[model samples]
Target chain A: MTRKAFITESDVRALAADLIAAGTRVVAPGRVGTPLGERIEYRVANKVDEILLGQDEPARSLKDFFLPPTDVILAWQEKKDQVELTPVSSTFAPQVIIGAKPCDAAALEIVDKVMDWDYHDELWFGRRAATTIITLACEGGDRSCFCTAVGLEPSGTRGSDVLLTPAAGGYSAEILTDKGEKLVAAHAVRFGADKGADEARAFAEKGRKRVDANLGLKPAEVRKWLAGHFDDAFWKSIALACHGCGACASVCPTCHCFDIVDECEGLGCGVRRRNWDTCQTAKFTMHGSGHNPRADQSSRMRQRVMHKFCIYPERFGEILCTGCGRCARVCPGGMDILEVVSKVNEMACGGAK
Target chain B: MAETKILAFVCNWCSYGGADNAGGMRLKYPADVRLVRVMCSGRIDPVFIIKAFERGADGVIVSGCHPGDCHYTAGNYHARRRFAVFRELMIFMGIDPRRVTFSWVSASEGGKWRDVVSETVERVRALGPFEGYRGLTGRQHG
Candidate 1:
């Protein structure tokens, strides 16, 4: 049977301390100060007070826990004119993520389709298997958010092992997957039978309404319009001020493009590493022979939109974006993706020929 | 093509030799061009030209030997077909086709090489520097 329980704010903290005491790494949304000032980041938490759960989405997504920004795949050594490659281990240690945003969690399930499409990414799945994600119903996003338009709500539990909704004194813990059940059972005293129904119900409603107030686009129409208009002049105007700094990609929940390079430390040894990359930049498609297919920012911008709205859905049966709105908030050029989608919606209506 | 910065992709056996001949004969070519030699014109991927423009090149030229005269027979033919599609696509995306010029110069035609370079330089100079995608870095003005 599925397990449902009530975890008070103090109970959640105790659970975190208990997990850490048992030598399991606990990850949560915590405040981090950057040059841009204080923003929440998904980081390791040593104490419960450090965590800021059920707030606005973290500046970064949960993808980093599964597919890190940079990872070493293999190492090589040239000994006596014979080169040998040593493979890196795919297995990782146990960890638990607390207070995940719904959009961030859903992005994992969406990207999982591609990561496992052609070839199984062993490292990606390895971390996934080793980690259990506990997601909190979101704190609500701003005008830039459009999660409801993409068929997701603030309470989405698509990828979380455990779903937590704020209640009277704490949260209503809905044990979702097998890992979540085992966790609650192993630490049975940390949770009590579900008794926070009224507060949790009201809180979930408020979150849903907050996100629903944002813009909604018909994904099917957006995809159809994008499929036929690769040469549209609308694309030229959409990216007029695009800085191509790729800050949007850097914060995107599902933008998972990466580049592999061989870094040599010395004449005898070297390592092959993969680093996150973005199509927003020209180097993403540049050829060593001095040619680039997606040459300018306009062309690159078109690819970004196409991949999210058309190519990915056609290939994977799902839209690429989760409507987290972090891209709009982070863009230096003021390129708002929601505004572009609104234009695409107007064009789809057959008025902008 | 631009008087400010013009880039050229020349085929090793022919266009490069044509440029060499012009220099050997003391022909005066425009000083705007910088040449990168590949084994054959077919080796020039469209990305090279895109990279050039992304780096602020105002004009670019891809020169090779006459189609049937390529050292590696049929290489220039492939480049011709590729550029035909790419050129139109660039125009559709608002990049002026005149900014990117394609020509065939034989090794014996040193004068033709000089003329192509001079003409490309003059045309691209008139059009001015490309600012279409410079906002991407925002540092282009710096």
Candidate 2:
């Protein structure tokens, strides 16, 4: 059975302070001053006061912590006629991520399927093994959030070691893993006896109801339509507004394609790095002979939706997206992924079909 | 000052010939530019420009035939439309669009090619190397 505890607001703060004092890396959602304005962002907490839990959504997801936007895979140097290679280490320092959104947390687990599928991604799995995630049951996210529609609840605990739900004067912490149990045991003084289960349940239900009103779609039906409709007219006109800027992929927690490039600093020595890449661009499918398979923005846009809903599910047994809606919110051309997927669902499962 | 590297994508029948003429005339132009000949300006995708930046080019130049003088009819016209949109994307991604120069140079205009080269090299030198894109490569975080 999962252990339950009532962690008061003061205790939460104290725990963060203790973790920081002990030289542990603690990440939390905090107010970040950006050129755009003060936005919530996940960052390594320097002070306990900087840790903000359960309010506005962070501008970016927790995926960046595990799988960074850019990483050096290896470095090569010229030695006479033969080239020498130096491989980067995959081991990482232990860290704890607090206040992860359920959708963002679940995305890691869903992507875990592919990361370990064909070849074991040592870099990806290295960070995963070293970190623990504590998810805050979401109470805020605008109309863009639709976690419930994608089989994830606002208080879902899929990839989280501990799930904290808001309650009266505290949070109801459900310790779901050995990591979570050990954390609570180490800080036993900071927790009280379980007393807010009812309040947490009520809070979770309210969050679910609010998110459900934003959008709804049958994912399986949408996947079926995407699998069969390779030449659907809906795709040809779907991305007229898309600039193929790939801003959506930058923000998407699950869009994990990367481009490997060798950057030579001098004549014979350089680093081979992998930077975040997206399919929305023409070059993603371009051949060396200059033939592009997905020549236009519309076809590229189709690939994004099809891969998320159909290809990933057929291969991994679960949908790639967690309905985080960052793709919709970040798209410069106002391309709403939820709306596009809903249209597919309507075409496949609505009364017309 | 460190020498800036400028990658130029030139059309085979027009800008390539123009570059050859400039070399033949010994017109004084910056040696910063490394010319890559393509079949047509239309063949240059924005990804090529992006990849150029990723590969350590301080700046890039795309020189094709004069609007109506493309060896393949309407090649430069297609290139023009693509560059216009690509410029906006470059700006959005925090890259200065000025780092990329788009110009027309027919085979007959050897002096014009020299001028384009000198002007682009001077402009890119002022902006300096693209460290912002370089920062995106290599290990950023753990």
Candidate 3:
């Protein structure tokens, strides 16, 4: 038998307090005072008023919580015979990330393959392992959402421990995994049996249909077309307007390219840092001896497209794009990925010869 | 005319072999093209390309295997895709995309190797020295 419960609006605050009292760090969206009124911010849940569960999505991504813009990876001191490398603390407290959308959770899974394969990244994995994600199905889809195109439903539970669907004046919580079950059991009294799970499911289906209508391409077909058209002129034509500002790459849920650098001062003490990098930048692939293989805009654009649709799937059996539509929204030139993928497919069918 | 400095990135499998073939035939191409061999064309990072221009290279040429003829099977394909995008980005930054060239050169194509070097040298000569990046970085031209 599966356990299901309804968490009413009034009980949300108490439930948040319970999670905090249980020694788990709870992160949820809140409003922070900025120069221009209050801006949505992710904050540690100390009070129930700090949690915002009904919003479409945060203005910024949840990636900053795991991979900060700048982190001290190493600290070293010069010694007589050898360099003394100070070990950074690996201790991380378990955390609960509430109100993540299904597409955001799915994006983490896509990132996990790149961060885990060949070289296991402890920084990213440690944070991921310590976090249990609770995803909320969008009652109404936003224009910037297209999760359905990338093999995700608005209500999909691909990367969540628990999935919550909106119900009449309450939320129907489904324990998707053992971890979620344990979490619910810790605060069982606050939740009651939800007999309206069937109705919530119907509401979620209606939301998924709106998402599907916005996504213009099926991911599998896009991947197939990209695999074959390695030398098409379509890349140059579409990518000509790209400024290489890296806004699209930075906002994208699955763009995970990074660069490692060692920094030092006059004292010979230094730290090695890994920072987010984008192929959209011209300096991403230059060699030490003054040679560059990827020295063109069309080539760089093709790389971004192929990395998302072709190479990633061939390596991980999953596409790197979650179709969060953040890239399209953030690109200065309005470089819509859906339009690019559509053109790729059209060319594959001999329409753009 | 002063000799133009050109950086040639030769992929380990094909273009490097093509360079060797040029040497074996004693085919006199411009000595201006300096060769830097890499494991695969795909492994060539775009940062190095920008660095070459910063260091006062008149031009840069990236030669790999004919699309599907890479020793690593699909290395050139990856290179092609990457370079196409990087080239566009450079152009948007006001760097002439012609300063960077991508061509499919096979190991047996010694004549093609000569042609690539001569053509790149002539083109860079017409463009004069690469002075745009030097002004921004405040570095002396070579």
Candidate 4:
């Protein structure tokens, strides 16, 4: 069993302050100013007070920390006769993330399966090893939140080193890994007896009940229906409103496609970078010979769903989605992924709709 | 410093013939421009232009027959409509749309081809090399 202890709100702040004072980078959820309005986002925290741990969902997830929007993988310099290649460093400095959402934290582990599948990504695993994730038990965002439906709970501890549950007086922190134990052991004075154990259980129970009402489906059954319905007309109708903007993939934690480009800095000197790419774009599937396998938005949209609910699970033994529902929440076309998933569940249970 | 590099995609029926006519007339233009002959302007996809920039072309030009003079009847018309949307997408992707130029050139317009090459080379030379795209490589992470 994992070790449990209580950390008062003030002690948590002191611990963060200590980390910052020691020159360690700390990232947490905080308000960010955008052109539209203020939204909560995970940003580098300069002070302890900037840390916001609550039920509010950040506009973005934690994937960017590990897999950046763009990064240089290598650089090339052409000589008179030969070319020299310089590989980018894969090592990263140690850091800590506080108050991460359970859905966002679990996403890293889910994506880890592929990063280590055929070719192990040194950069991704380098950052993963250099950082310790402290996840805050969620209240599960609005009805769009469906972690429970995807075999995760509001207080799930899949990818977290330490799981913190909100309770009366303070938070009950469960040390699940050696990293978490090291953190608590160094700041032993900041931890105490687990006084909020009962209240933490109640808080988790209430959160589960609230999220359970969002969507109910069997993952295996949904995958079966999706695998069999590759050419169904339902895909065409479901994608009628979609414009293939790819905003869903931008916000989705598990959509990990990337495009590599070699851009020249000057004559004969250039860098090869891998930038974030999505399957929703026409160019993503466009062949050099002017042939496009996915010629329409319908096929593209179906590919997104199929990859998440069917293909990944069939290969990885788990679903690709944490059911964060950011895809449904940010879609400009008003397309709902969960609604499509619920339809799949219905068809798998009874008959095709 | 090296001279600016500009890539031009020209139609086999019109713009390519215009370039050949310029060569036959012995007209002097900037040697920085490189020509790529295509069956029609409509055959050029936006990805080709993007790929050109990725491969170190500082600027790009697409020249074909006038709208009504297309050999396939509507190849230039399709190219016009596609480029209108593609320019906007380039802007959204943080690329300066000014780096791309679209023009009409008839097979007999050799003087016009020389003027187009001169102007495009001058404009792109002022804009300098596309260092903005190169800078994007290591920008997103710490």
Candidate 5:
């Protein structure tokens, strides 16, 4: 357990139960019944039977738990002569996430740059410090996922504490961090001796090849192209079909724009909250005079791409996306990110217009 | 002092002067319109209008010089084109078109400014308070 080891499929399940029984939150990708069919989503799993071993990517990333869609930031009360306000605290309980996709895991680390840029986001890092991530090698991404292109492989352990690859009995577990080593040590009975040094190499190789076929682009080249094309006609044509819905932001792991609102509940008291918002809408940049910088869908679309590729990279020295492909999958309009990136890369390389 | 808070952005050369003329002539209009004067209507960014609405505006107005009479030559024309696109986006986002009003006023048109403010107040009163962006003021959930 101190080094590389082998965990049987049933042993992994037992490990999940052990974590839950010890009052630690155990989260994993599980099947939820939707109108169409079963959708895999990361949910709190209590028992071994609840965890979905290897399935499709979750409908959303782990960002939902860390950042949350909406949360209260502060509460206030007004008196005759004075106003009182109280701020929210950033503290979380220890938890374990099993079966996380590598792209999703890497997203956490990529976003960590922005969350800690100027203001150290207390809530974001609070959850990060308290949770241990165990990523499952991905093999299910279609043509939309591009984790490898953004310096992450399907089996990459960029943000994971432990990396689990499917092997003969269950998973070939590679202990990644101190937390991962501790996790294996705590459940040493579940993980057996390693079969070999490269026990899980074959499994990771196949998974990597599967996602590699999706799409690839040079992140630096795309950033360079975006830097020069702020007013390009391509932005207009590329987003022509977009209905300006912010669904892409809702699914994006790295798209972390939020609106802070103060809500008066009733009778001299209120709460200030932050909710997820996106630049895809005109309201995002609207001024008090009814003037909008990103006044049209075209400009808003360009902002989204520029933030992910150029602006974020130039400012934070890192691209703001993990290439999880959820945005393309959930787009109601035919707005495909792969097409957008490919076009930018093509333009950079002096290829097709 | 009015219960209905209306955010009005006025161009310094035209709409602002028109509003000043109305005040000088003692022309009565709804006091609900809180005015913020910009050197030119073209200086207005749609985000300012959005921030006004989000910050608890019942209604908003963007008044500037008439099409050809902009003191900045063609500043109002640029604003006109910008609003044309911004209005379409607002409608697509499910915001009521009536909640936001746009008009062109000249420096000599004090009577017109009075009428526009009164009519806009009435129209917005009929529509009632806009709580779509209530989260901004700590009033209610959006």
Candidate 6:
């Protein structure tokens, strides 16, 4: 498709500032720690440099910015004639997320399916609708990134309003939808006409190579292997060292299992909350009558693999994993899911009948 | 021998009916399995499974409709996916995955219900007792 060099670095910052001035809240990755090696922190966009665009993915995910760790859903108060169901305070302001990678935006789209499937999650959807995401294409992907493995490319514009590709000291910004058009129109002075389209394509190709190298196996093949190997011994072997810390699932960009709880505060006053839960935790599938269905690590390991590969695809026709490699990085026991899937596939192909 | 306590989380539509069918048939299976009926297999939260273990149940079974026969069309599909992952988590925690069993039992399958209970009881009996991971406040027995 045709592309345009919308804004330079200086112009991008000016556009962000203009958006903020025009009553649109801007959120971007802010720098934390010292100059030697800095960490990224999600904060409101004010300064241009604070918005880390075209860098590697952040250590933390964009999930926290939308679905917070903990929040009150509903408040209840008892009355003489009727019981009042007071909704929690929703202070969602319309905002623009600058410098979001395409992979992260795609992950949000994947999560939205489950969250909005059976139940309408107002809290998550509220934040999503109120924000316009502008994804900056990765000039170079990191060693841990494998967004391409799960039907996404580093430069793919699957779930972004505006997709910005790096060009000659500027960005070849493609207006993806009405949202992108509106965002650009809001700060028309910063945007320029088409300039370096070929350079952006070259950068995207380099980024795609890095992404493909990280993914050793195809997602479709992994799903097929998992479908048949529900009773494999590989699950027992790899999951033996698992401490069930649930760090992998918590840090994963796609793991969206949650539990809703009601907290009572004396005379019928209470708050309902939805907290993130993980299948990697031992207590995840425990029953009320004192029976734990998945009481051991081996079975738990099997469940984790099957859920991602077999069951999720059966239901949603999509693999639950984004291949971001966060689970492999964060897992305390060095439980690499890629290695596990590969081994399982090998066993299946070898006619282990 | 101490009584084997089995906790069964049955889906309201199929598995629960199967269990009820077992009762109607007067098919004598082990009385060890206690049934807790839920709206659907999808409603069987992971917390409920953990709480059952904490409360001292020796075994837990999550029974629902067959893959394609779910009353809600795909509730069992979601449940299967959930338990698949939950099983992995349990295995990592030094827990025996055999203690938890997930099976498909439709409403008409009274015979299957008996078989499930029989198999689960036998398996739990082989595993002996679950005294390993007790709750924080629960009494620990040697």
DockQ of each candidate, alpha-carbon based: 0.01, 0.19, 0.01, 0.16, 0.03, 0.01
Best by TM-score: 4
> lDDT by residue for model 1 over A1-353, one digit each (tens)?
45678898888888888998888889999999889899889998887788776576788888888777877788899999899998888888888998888898899989989999989998888887888888898756788888888888887778888889887788898888998888888888989889776776777778778877877677889899999999989889988899888988888999999999886643577678877999998888999997999888889999999999899999999889989999999888888999998789878875676
Compared with the true structure, the alpha-carbon lDDT of candidate 2 equals 0.88
- Share of the reference A-B contacts seen in candidate 4: 0.20
Clashing pairs in 2: none
Question: Can you give the lDDT of residue A249 in candidate 2?
Answer: 87
Candidate 6 lDDT, B69-103, residue by residue in tens? 99999999998999999999999987898988899
TM-score result, candidate 2? 0.74
Which of candidates 2 and 6 reaches a greater DockQ? 2
Give per-model TM-scores.
0.70, 0.74, 0.68, 0.75, 0.70, 0.67
CAPRI-style class, candidate 4: incorrect
Ten-residue segment with the worst summed lDDT in candidate 1 chain A?
Answer: A262-271
Best by lDDT: 4
Span of 10 residues, lowest total lDDT, candidate 5 chain A: A195-204
Q: What are the chain A TM-scores of the candidates, in order?
A: 0.96, 0.96, 0.92, 0.97, 0.95, 0.90
Docking class of 3: incorrect
Model 2 lDDT, residue A192, Cα: 88
In CAPRI terms, model 2 is classed as incorrect
lDDT value, residue A28 of candidate 3: 81
Instruction: Encode model 2's per-residue lDDT on B1-142: one tens digit a residue.
Output: 5689999999999999999999899898889999999999999998999888877788999999988888889988999999999998879877798899999988888999999988888989999888778556435447
Query: Tens digits of per-residue lDDT for model 5 on B35-142?
Result: 999999999999988878766788889999999998889999999999999999999998887888899988889999998888889988988888757554433211
lDDT (0 to 1) per candidate: 0.85, 0.88, 0.79, 0.89, 0.85, 0.79
- Expressed as tens digits, the lDDT of each residue in A1-353 for candidate 2 is 68889898888889889999999899999998879789888899999999997578888888788778878888899999999999888898878888889888899999999999989999999999888888899874678888888888888889998888989898999999898888889889998899899999998989889999988878888888888899988998889999998988888888889999887764688888888999999999899999999999889998999889999999998888888888888888888988888788889888554
Q: TM-scores for chain B, in order?
A: 0.92, 0.95, 0.93, 0.91, 0.91, 0.92
